[model samples]
Target: MAKPGVRPLTGWLFVAPCALVFAVFTLWPMLFNGWLAFQDYFIAERVAAWNDFANFVTLYKSATFRLSITNSLLMLLTVPIIQAGALGLALLVHRKLPGIAFFRATFYLPVVITVSIAAIVWRYVFHYDGMLNWLLTAIGVFEPGHGPQWLDQHVPALIAVMLFAFWKNVGYYMVLYLVGLAAIPRELTEAAVLDGAGPRARFIHITLPMLAPVIVLCTLLSTIAALKTFQEVLTLTGGSGETVTALYFVYNMAFSGFNFGAAGAAALLFTLVCLAVALVQVRVMGRHNPFRRPA
Candidate 1:
């Protein structure tokens, strides 16, 4: 039998390493990045001079930054599409049927593939003479070799990016919904059935309410992921065709252009936007959170 305080101290000792690592790697970098946002950082001299908020002012006046922000916001359109598709897929595969596991694995295969590889594959699919154009031509949507340049135009490129996002992420969300569905007590649905509720009514009244917390969680995750869209744009369009996202812009500013100060400012602004969106989502979705105590 140890002393009363000994166990608590031992627990804290176990936690100390993780805490130190987080402080060093996460907290320190965030603080340094915030500080760097207000300075003119010279890479060659390894010196930083105070810039009097010029970085922020320049980013605000940049048309490319504005367009990047707009494109990032536009990516939010994929959230609802992905969520709805995931839920539908979850419902379809949540049964005791033969070959169900194969279908589930097939859907989720995309989620495990490397993003660069997946994006490269999709780049081919969207190429002018790609399979998609071939299929569309076969269906009379376009003439052979006259297909739209999917990665060269603005709207088409954005749509292609959204499609890629949906394809890559929907399966992951489907797994989440499947777990949520499995956790739901079958008695509730049975009771609703006994009360003469039909399939649509049962889903509306029982399934939706029971899955509220999962729905909220998935929605928040999807929204944040959409707003942080980067790899798809980078690999697919290479920041061309007006498909540059906020994160991609920051990457270019920092790594490609060597404008670290402006990049830091853009990163901080993007962080704030994500934080605001998350807060708003929590406020709106808090009621559905199962962990919330009733007032």
Candidate 2:
């Protein structure tokens, strides 16, 4: 056996490796990036000069940056769409039915696929003469060879990105809801049924209340993912001004434009926006938290 003090030390020893990696890879880089936001970083000469907030000023005045922000905000509309669709899917799959496991696996397949690969496949679907238009024509929604340019126009391109986001992420949220539904005590639902509560009544009263935490969690996650959307836009439009997002703007600034300082500022601003949204969500959703202790 070990001494009482030795056990605590050993626990810390086990945690030290992971803690060190987080400090080196995550903490240090974030700190450095924050520092870079305030300085004009010269890549070749390894020099950095204080820029006196010029980068942020420039970003504020930039039409492209403003458009990117608008597109990112527009992506927020998909959060509800994804969440509702996922909940519907989870409810559909939660029943005892033949071949339910296969259906669950099939729905979740998209979550495991590489995002870049999936976006590339979607690029083809959004192409002017792609399957989407072909189907639309077949359905008589569009005349032959007269479909709107999906990837060229701003509104359509943004809509395409939103569609891709929904298809790629709904299954993941569905799994989350499945787990939440599983954890709900069947006793409550069964008792409600015995009390003459119909399916809709039980779901509205018991099920929704119990699943509040999970709803909050999925909503928060979906919101963050929508705000940080980058890969879909990158692959679909290649940072075309129409579908460029804030994160993609940061990428273009750092890698393509070689303006690390501006990129750093944009990144910091975006991070603060994400943090603000998360805080607001927690505050608003925490009110519905069934497990919270009374004040």
The TM-scores of all predictions, comma-separated, are 0.93, 0.92
What is the C-alpha local distance difference test score of each model? 0.93, 0.91
Q: For model 2, what is the error of residue 11's alpha carbon versus the real structure, in angstroms, after optimal superposition?
A: 5.7
Residue-wise C-alpha lDDT for candidate 1, range 98-159, written one tens digit per residue: 99999999999999999999988898899998988999999999987899899999999999
The regions of model 1 sitting more than 4 angstroms off are 1-8, 143-146, 289-294
lDDT of 2: 0.91
Error of 1 at 291 (Å): 8.5
Q: Mind giving the per-residue lDDT tens digits that candidate 2 earns over 1-295?
A: 7786687679789999999999999999899999999999999999999998999998999888889888888999999999999999999999999999999999999999998899888888988999899999999999999997888899888999899999999999999999999999989988998999998998899888988889988998899899999988887788763899999999999999999999999989888888887777767776764446779
Q: Who wins the lDDT comparison?
A: 1
For candidate 1, what is the TM-score? Answer: 0.93
Worst 10 residues of 1 by lDDT: 283-292
